[model samples]
Target chain A: MKVLKGAYSGLIFLFLYAPIVVLIAFSFNGAKSRGAWGGFSFRWYESLAQNADILHALRNTLIVALLSAVVATIIGTAAALGMHHMRRGLANFMLNVTYLPVLNPDIVTGISLLILYVFIGINLGFSSLLLAHITFNIPYVILSVSPRLKGMNRHIFEAALDLGAGPVRAFFKVIVPEILPGIVNGFLLAVTLSIDDFVISFFTAGPGVSTLSITVYSMARKGIKPEINALSSIMFVVVLLLLLTVNIRAGRDIRRRAQTHVRSHSPRALSSREH
Target chain B: MSELIRLVNCVMAFDDVTVLNSINLTIKDKEFLTLLGPSGCGKTTTLRIIGGFEVPTSGDVFFDNVRINDVPPYRRRVNTVFQRYALFPHLNVFENVAFGLRVAKVPKADIERRVRESLDLVGLRGYDKRASHQLSGGQQQRVAIARAIVNHPQVLLLDEPLGALDLKLRKEMQIELKRIQQQVGITFVYVTHDQEEALTMSDTVVVMNDGVIQQIGTPVDIYNEPKNAFVADFIGESNIVPGVMHRDCEVSFAGRVFRCVDTGFAPDEPVDVVIRPEDVRLSPPEEGQLDGEVLSVTFKGVHYEMMVRARDFTWMIHSTASEPVGARVGLSVRPFDIHIMHRAEKTEAAS
Candidate 1:
């Protein structure tokens, strides 16, 4: 049974990664042909580095992702905290309202946001794309942060006030620290979502304001280039590293929390001896 | 001690559901006053009002003769050791204790010295670098206390700080808390549902029930002279039964007239008679006033607690001597141990 399970998992991994592996391999091919690998070389990577349009698209992606992630995290965290303190009925209503955007299709959100922006007479460009990303990212940030707020002891806020810190001071000193891990996790998720988004960006971006995903799509019509393959390989590695870091930090946090919980409940004689 | 804080006709309500009704209390300086009651009795609400966390719906709160109803908690000269020890999880012991001082912009050296001193006060010396989560419940409690007291607030509020500890640790912390209160010479407004804890650590015990103060007095006074049946039953194990005040010192209950020390009741007025379990002395059937068969007996470490059926009431009597179940025994209570109070409904009407 164990051998069968291991074989099954190995096959699933291969099935999932086989295409990506082929793409990565072709990124190193010296020949321009799609099928023939003349030998491993860095020619595609060198070409990708020299592509100013791709570099500009990458810069746009980073800027939008970073800016939208930060803005969404701030707005979402504040909204979650406000809802957390609301009456149960109102808080539940607010939470369901937050979930609506997340549950709605990305295409629907993109179209609606485009319509709203057009109705408001705003020009479509980097600003429109950023606004759309922020709007979609806020719900993800709220979902990630709501759990941390729920698990938190509400008394810490009152304790801060009792300890001579005003509302803003206490929020920064105690409340923010308590929910910081959640905020960072949400920000990372927002960054990934904003970078990975294509459907929304396509609908929102103007002629000159294109992210990396849109640029890749536009480049696809000109026959797929090995430079695109090299670029994708690097992006995949970066995303994989980002995911690995998030998972490792999350696992460490859970383990540390469990350890502290066990330690807190350990025998008094055992804990006192640590002194 | 001079008066430090007063709640004059304070009425607190949440969404039209009143949690505190016309609460009038005056806390004196250097006094360890405990608000003792069962859950939902408005004791915690009273503490919150005094801590400036909750504003009274329609009343005045005076701090040192100045009305502070509109003051925010951060502006008040008060601190609270929360029920679950709400220590900051991100901060270490030293930083948690120094939080108040830092917010007040105290000198760096003073903050250091004061944090160390407060940690020592809570018996957590040399634990400055320990994370809040690393400490046990007892140690966390100490950190919470240290954090609150480091500010040197004129009044400290503790909302059932030791409710989470085991019995042994709770008892030790109760004594430790009393010693700390005396050492600091600051008013402590403690809240708890445990009557024994209130009696152990408080100079004044305020027994509350149903959003109203049932009785407020010294521990001995509240215990020996409960204002009504609720206070009597809540404070300790009391065998309260209906009776009629025939005159000044005479009351009748359980088909027999008993002499009590309570007076100031109208002739033939209905009252409740309170008898403490330990106050009942057991003797031979022929040598006592009320004879009953022992129904059950259980050894309670220091005493053998027995239930005896006498007339219409089952009397709980605590004695070192064990009475076998189904055995005949007699119960006699001393005149001073028998307390009489106006009936609860009548008292409410009068109030």
Candidate 2:
């Protein structure tokens, strides 16, 4: 049974990654042909950097992801903090309202945001695309932060206030530090969603400007570009490196804490012990 | 002593569910007062009101004769030791204790001096850099006390601060806390569901249930002379029986009239009488006021608690010696042991 389950997971992983693997391999092909064996080379990677259109699209994608993620994180975190102290029924109702965007289909959200932008007669450009990304990214941030807010001890906030710190000062000093891990997780998740989104970006974006996903989708109509594969492969490697660094840091922290607790007692213990 | 804090008919409700109903209480200066009740009995809510964490729906709260109903928590000169301690996990012990001083923009040297003093007062003098999570439960509780007291607030509100500790540690901390309160000479408002904890540390125990105060008195008065059936049952082990007050120093129960040192009830009025388990003396069946067979016996370290059956009712009796099961014995209670109280409404959990 274990072998069967392992085989099932292997098949699922291969099914999910097969196309990406093929793309990465073709990016290194020596000749311009699909399905034919060609010696490996780095020509596509070399050519990708000089391609102004693809580079522009990459820049646009990076800008939208960074800005949208930051704005959405701030608004979502503030909204969660405000809603945390509200009456329970009202807070629950507001939370359910926030969940609607996350539960609704991307196509529906894309269409509605498109309609609203058009109705307002705003010009559809980089601003419109960034707004679209920000609009959809907020719900994910709220979902990530709400659990941390729920687990927090609200009395600490009151304790801070009671200790002569005003409201804003208390929030930054006490509340922020407690919920920081959740906030960072929410920001990262928002950035990931914003970077991969294409539907809303397509509907809202104007001509002459494109994000990485939009550029890739447009390239697919004629034929898949090996240069596009090269860029994605680069992105994939960067993400993997980031993950490795984060894991190593977290593991070292845990080990250090364990050593401190198990190996050495605080000075108070030794000082207070009787002969 | 003067009044340090007063709640004048404070009423609090969320939606239609009332949590505190018209509570009027005064906490005197330098006195240890405890709000004692079961979970959801509004004891914690009362503490929160005093700390200015919650505004009453329609009442006033006075702190040293000044109405503070609109005052926010930051303006109130009171600190609370939360139930969970709620120490900042990011900071070290020294930093946590020094937070209030830093917020008040105190000088660096003054903050250091006061932090050292507070830590010394809690017996954590040399441990400045220890993280909160690294400390034991008792140590963390002490840190919380130090953190609150370092500010020198006029009143310190503790909400079951020792509830998370084990029995041995909790008992030790109870004595430690009482000593600290006396040394600091601050009015301490403590809230706990543990009756024993309240009795040990409080000068005034306010027994509450279902959003209302059942009775308020010293621990001795609360135990020896409970005003209602709920207060009597909630305080300690008791055998409450239905009785009638015939007249002064006279009551009737157990199918016969008995003399009790109680009065001020209408003639032949129905009442409830409370008899503590320790007050019942047992002897041979032929030489006591009532006779009963011992149904069960369990050893309780210092004494043996036995269940005696008589008149279709079971009476719990605590004795230094044990009696064999199924042995019939006569039980006698002194007249002062029979505490008479008027009937109370069914507002608390059943015994």
Candidate 3:
């Protein structure tokens, strides 16, 4: 039964990755037609380097992702803190409303934001695109951070204040450090959503401001370029490298925690000596 | 000694649910005081008010004859050893202990010296570099104590600082905390739900329940002469029975009139009578005050606790000897052992 379950999961993994794997494999194809298996070459990678349009979209994607992630993290974490101390009924109501943008269809949220921007007479360019990205990203940030705020011990903050730190100092010294893991998680989630977004960016971005996802969608109309495949392959490698770093760090933390547990309960502490 | 802290007419209601009701309390300088009560008894809320974490709804808190109602916690001359030992997880023991000193902007050399001294006092020497998670619960508690004491606050508030420890460690830390309190001569206001912990470590134990102070006295006074049935039952094992005060030095209980020392009640006034478990003695049915049947007997390590039913009252008796179940026995109570008080409005039935 266990082996059968393992085989099932393996098949599911292959099904999810097969297309991306094929795309990456075709990025090395010497021929332009992705359907035919051409001999391996770096021709597409060289062409990808020369593709300035794709480069501009990539730059736009990075800027939007970075700024939106940071701004959304600040706003969302502050909102989570405010909700942490609110009355249960009101907090529940606000939390339910916060989930509305997240649960709604992405197209609906995108078009609604676009309509609001147009009504306000704001041009649909970098600023509007950034604002729309931040608006959609904040709900995800709040969802990830709210649980951490709820789990924190309220007395810990009071302890910080009682230790002679002022309210502002205590917040930075105690509250921020305690909720930092949640904040980073929220920021990373926001960045991924912003980078992968197409429907939202397509609606809000003007002609000069196109993200990588929107660029890919537009390129699909004209025969998809081999250089786009190369770009996708590069992005896959970058994401893989990021995941590798994050997983290694998380594994180290778990091991360090286990080692600390063993050392503390080791019958004799051996007194961690400092010279 | 003069009062170091005074809470006058303090009333705290959180979202219309009263947690502390018109509490008037005073803390003397250089004394170890403990607030002892069950959960939801408002002991912790009172401590938070003194620590300046909560402003009472309609009362003034004074420190050295100065009203500090508007003063924030950082400006108060107080530090706290939190219940869970809220040590900063990101900092090592040395840094956690030095946090208060650094906040006050003490000289770096002095901060180091004081942190070392406080850690040494808690017998956690050489634990400076250890991370908070790298220490055991007892060690974490010690670090918390060291951190609070390093600031040298005029008053140290401990909110059940030893609530999370094994019995042996809890006992050892109780004595250790009392020793540290005396050594520093800092007014320590400790809160705990454990009656034994409060009695063992505190110079004065204030027993509170239902957002009101039941009684405040030394351990001996509180134990030997409880003000009401709640104090008697909460402090230790007791056999409480309804009785009537006929006059001064006279009372009727267990279906018989008995002489007693307590007085100042109206004639034939219904009262609550308290007799400690150890005070009830056993003898042959022919040679005692009241005859009863032995319902059960159980060994309680130091002594065997036997339940004797005399008339309608089931008396808990503590003795070294054992009587078989269903054996006829006589229960005796000396007049001096019987403590009486006017019946509390919320009478508690004793089993």
DockQ of each: 0.51, 0.33, 0.38
Measured against the true chain A, the candidates' chain A TM-scores are 0.92, 0.84, 0.86
Report lDDT per candidate: 0.90, 0.87, 0.88
User: lDDT per residue, candidate 3, B1-351, as tens digits?
Assistant: 878899999999988899998999999999899999999999999998999888999899999999999999989999999987888877899999999999999998899899999999999999999889888888998999999999889999999887767667778999999999999989999999889998899889999999999999999999999999899999998998999999999999889999899879999999989999999888999988999999999998999999998899899999999899999998888889999988887763332
lDDT for each residue of candidate 3 in A170-256, tens digit (9 for 90 to 100): 999988987776777788778877887889899999778898888777887787889889888887777666556545644555576
Cα lDDT for residue A259, model 2? 55
Q: What is the per-residue lDDT of model 1 for residues A1-275, given as tens digits with 9 covering 90 to 100?
A: 99999999999999999999999999999999999988999999998888999999999999999999999999999999899889999999999999999889989988998899899998999999999999999998898888888878789999999998989999999988888888888898889888888999999987899998898898987889888899889888877877777677677777877887676556444525533
In terms of docking quality, how is candidate 1 classified?
A: medium
Per-model TM-score versus the true fold: 0.95, 0.88, 0.92
Q: What docking class should model 3 receive?
A: acceptable
Q: Give candidate 2's error at residue B274 in angstroms.
A: 1.9
Off by over 4 Å in 2: A1-22, A25-43, A82-108, A219-226, A238-275, B345-351
Better of 1 and 2 by DockQ: 1
lDDT of 3 at A191: 83
TM-score, candidate 3, first chain:
0.86
Ranking of all predicted structures according to TM-score, beginning with the best and ending with the worst? 1, 3, 2
Instruction: Give the distance in Å from residue A247's predicted Cα in candidate 3 to where it truly belongs.
Output: 6.3
Off by over 4 Å in 3: A1-10, A35-38, A240-275, B348-351
